[model samples]
Target: MTDQLPDAIVAGPKGPALDLLHIVQINEEIKSVVAVAFKINIMALNAIFLAKRAGTAALGFGVLSNELRSFSSQLRETMLSLNALIHASVDGVSAMLQDSRYNDILERAVVLASKNKHLQEVIEQRENATDQFRSKLSGLRRALRSSVDDAYRLVELGGVLAKSAKIEAAYGAGFSSSLSQVSGEFDGIVEEIRTSLDTLRKSSFFRG
Candidate 1:
């Protein structure tokens, strides 16, 4: 059960820190994008379903739904760019993973010591990089690294939709699209989550 999810996965050993500081950051960014793209696609697909039920009345709000769809397209484009980053990270780590000299230097750090948000932000980025490689350095390895970064970016986009939902409620404006969008996105999050976790489990790390 635990092996089926990459979210809580923490790497154990079998490697040194691949000298990939810059590429690692790029990989996280890509992960954020893939996550976001999955989310947006689900949202748009849900919106389509909702609009169909709303009938002609929903047509009046077509412009709004269209705008939301535009956001989804942009998110996909961003994910594509992140795909390139994933390739680079994979290339850097492939050679290092097979070497025995690289001991277990790829685990999580202790606690984050930061009073300021900026410093804390820096620490969080560093933590995610280590966690990303620790858990996913093999198998999909770097290919999925970009996908993980996309997940965070997806959450960020959700933050926008959540706020928009609040606005939709304030004036009694019936943008049911907001509700359906979120519902669909939630479904997507669950699915990809399972997919990623299952993938990580099949890696050489857990070989019996």
Candidate 2:
């Protein structure tokens, strides 16, 4: 029979055992989310630097930039910690699966009723672990989705800030048009991030 499953498992069937490979794929997605946060943080820092260079005239914007950078930094750290947990879980699952020899047993034409008590216990243990990881990964996906939305808000706020700075610069304030340029750049980056997040959320991995 042809295996209908993809190279990566999105959401596994509601069973106790999961595909470690799929968990690894999920970790990759988590990393991607972290990377996006890092990029936003870098951009926010750049904005802050520009605001500081504008001196006393842009003090308010400078403060806002610092806040934005801080937010992004916090987000990145959270995602990184989550990703680490996932990696550890993956390793543990892989070890358990190997020790139980469930994959090998499952591949054989053995009858469930004829299985020994030890094998049954192992199977149950694997199933419980699988269910737990599934739940954890689901929560992580939700968190990542929320983070993406937060990033979009940041970019939107950034655009507004740029517009404000541009107006002030036009009024002969000691600010530079670089604010406007950064705003436009952020607009482009945010659009790309939105598209990517939309596609990611639509994937089978994100399915309930």
Best by TM-score: 2
Report, for every candidate in turn, its global Cα lDDT versus the true structure.
0.49, 0.59
Worst 10 residues of 2 by lDDT: 13-22
Count of clashing residue pairs in every prediction: 19, 1
lDDT of 1 by residue, 2-109 (tens): 546564235533333333443454455447546655665666566656655665655533434445566566656656655664575456465445332322232122
Please give the distance, in angstroms, between residue 103's alpha carbon in candidate 2 and its true position after superposition. Answer: 5.7
Q: Compute the lDDT of residue 163 as modeled in candidate 2.
A: 49
Estimate, for each residue in 1-208, the C-alpha lDDT of model 2 and write its tens digit.
7768764365553322454554556567657767776887788788778877878876765665676577567656655665665666566556555644654575352375555777677667767876676566566556655655564565455446444544544432555467666655555654554554455445443444
TM-score of 1: 0.39
In order of appearance, the predictions have TM-scores of 0.39, 0.56
Assess candidate 2 and give its TM-score to the true structure.
0.56
Worst 10 residues of 1 by lDDT: 101-110
